[model samples]
Target: MKSILNRRNVALSGGPSRLLAVAHDAATQRTAAASDAAAHDPHAASASGSPADSVVEIESRAEPAAGATLPGEGASGPRPVSTLHAVPVMPAHLNGRPVQIADGAAFEALRAADELTTFRVYRCFAYTVSLFFHPPTLGYFVALHQESVLWRALKANDLDAAGSAFHLMQEQATRLADGETRRAQLVAQNAELARLIEESETQAERLRVDLQRHSEQEQTVTGRQHQVRKEVAQLEAQRIAAQAQLNKAHRALHQLKVATSEGVPHLHAR
Candidate 1:
């Protein structure tokens, strides 16, 4: 009887243990399934409850095709980029030279200003400042402005505005360079034109001198022609006087011959 009781207690305890093992196994399996389901369902971990499905959302947000300006975007007004009113404090040696700033400070300052204005200021300063030593400050300012504009545009759901801002920044830089190049070309062209004009004037002066010399030569020729005509007239007058003297001499000779003939016949007869 004692042995039978012990056997029955052992059987009952073994049954509960088997049942518990089965329950634990089922619970573990269920937990694994739930984990698998959660893994498959991407929305499970997302804040918006649904995971981004499209390739675009997975990569980057979509932008509008046509370039358009959204409302309340970019610089406040169409004002020119401002100048650097004050330089940050630096060591005595770097006071007058380009000064480097902490990236954080530069970024904060750029973020506080208008995006367009900030970009303009950066560009303006970049033109005047050396970027090598001041790379941190310049890079920070550019990144800050870019992020601010991008964030603002995205928040407002204004893709066009964001694109426009980016394009405007690029265009403004290009235009500035173009303007400088054009000005230089204009200056060179003006100088060339001035030089050409001077050369033309010089040539004209030389031509004028040649013309004046030619005119003098013409006058001299005219005077020589007049003297030649006067000489011709004097020679014609002398020829006419010589012809008259010859005629008178011929007449006297004829008279003398006739008188001689008549006197010879009279003397012979005497």
Candidate 2:
């Protein structure tokens, strides 16, 4: 998605940060310059008192014209009031990354409309960068990261390269966000897979226990079959012995009957 400038953004145009940073630096310089001037120029100190006195004097006579003199103000005649304009300063860092201020086209345009803009300056590596202002939206963007060559091109005033780098930076940021999201998703998926593997192992363990029980039952059945076979064999042998004994008794009885008949016949004949 094309990003809308919010917490993260930048415009790699003409020296925007350079201009903003300069503007900010200019304000501080102006105050320092004023102090220096006051100390060095006796006439200035006589007219406007001192740097400390000038501040108070300016505050009291906010609308006094330059060269306007105060009553009882010694020999230096009337002293013009110092200009009281605001000095613009950009933030020192963007999202914890150290940055250096550079010039930008957008800032130049805004500086042209100085009455309307609150421009800012920044540092991009060893290079300087800038930001634009819009009174209507009251919004601006701070670039989190930029391509190395992109900043170099922007510094060299290579707008073509700068624009390309800007686009590349956008893509880089989106890809990074996507990469993190995918990583998180993979981590969650891996956790789920690990859980499934654990459950499968538990089920396999139960099946193994069931298989062991079945094997033991089978062994018991096999042992019983062997015992029954031995008992059948013994019963078969006992039956065979009983039959033989009965047959022997029968034979003896038959022989005894024959002998008795023979003895009776002999007695009758006599």
Candidate 3:
């Protein structure tokens, strides 16, 4: 009976040891599979950590506004802006047409016309003074008037009128100078004529006295007549020379009058 009881206890203990070994092998296999899964999946936590740690990391990555700075971004700073006011522009006129005088041509035209008008008025005043103070200065007044006309035409930008007026004024000045020269020559001739008349009177008186003395003394009458004839001849020659000079002066005067009449009627008539 003792041997049978020992056999039964040994069989039960052996069976329990085998079951414990199998359970330990199965637990090891499960633990190895869990480790493999965790290694494959990046979202999976380690055996030592909980799921809450992974949640916190995900939230930190998504919510980047939590005291995190992005690349190439900065806070606000100061900048500048303009506050100056702009100026206004004025317009100008050309001919009879109204236009903006912005460019060179338009500005030049406007400025030239304004300056020309002022010059014209000043010239007219000068001419008026010349006319009143000096009548012989009519030639200068006429010239100034003609120049005013030319500048007026230039102010209007008319080249043709200005050229024609300039030519006319030059002709007038020439005529005036010619007239003055001829008048001076005539006055010189008149003086020469007066001198000749005085010389002829003196020669006549001398001849009369010689004739009377010869009549009183017949012995020397022939010599006295010869001397008187010689004196008369010299006086006649001087008178002829004076007449010739007078005639030449008259001819020059006539020619100048004709030229003046044709060239400048205004000054000549004045």
Best-fitting candidate, scored by lDDT? 2
TM-score, structure 1 vs. true: 0.34
Q: Which runs of model 2 end up more than 4 angstroms from their true locations?
A: 1-170, 249-270
Question: Which digits, one per residue and each the tens of the lDDT, describe model 3 over residues 180-262?
Answer: 66877899999999999999999999999998877778857777889899999999999999999999999999999998889
What lDDT score belongs to each candidate, Candidate 1 first? 0.46, 0.50, 0.46
Top TM-score prediction, candidate number? 1
Could you tell me the lDDT of residue 85 within candidate 2?
A: 97
Candidate 2 lDDT by residue in tens digits, 13-45: 211122233333444555687778876886875
Say what the RMSD of model 2 is.
26.0
Residue range with the least summed lDDT across 10 consecutive positions in model 3: 126-135
TM-score of every candidate relative to the true structure:
0.34, 0.30, 0.22
> Higher-lDDT candidate among 2 and 3?
2
Q: Model 3 reaches what TM-score against the true structure?
A: 0.22
How many residue pairs clash per model? 0, 24, 0
Compute the lDDT of residue 186 as modeled in candidate 1. 100
For model 1, what is the error of residue 184's alpha carbon versus the real structure, in angstroms, after optimal superposition? 1.6
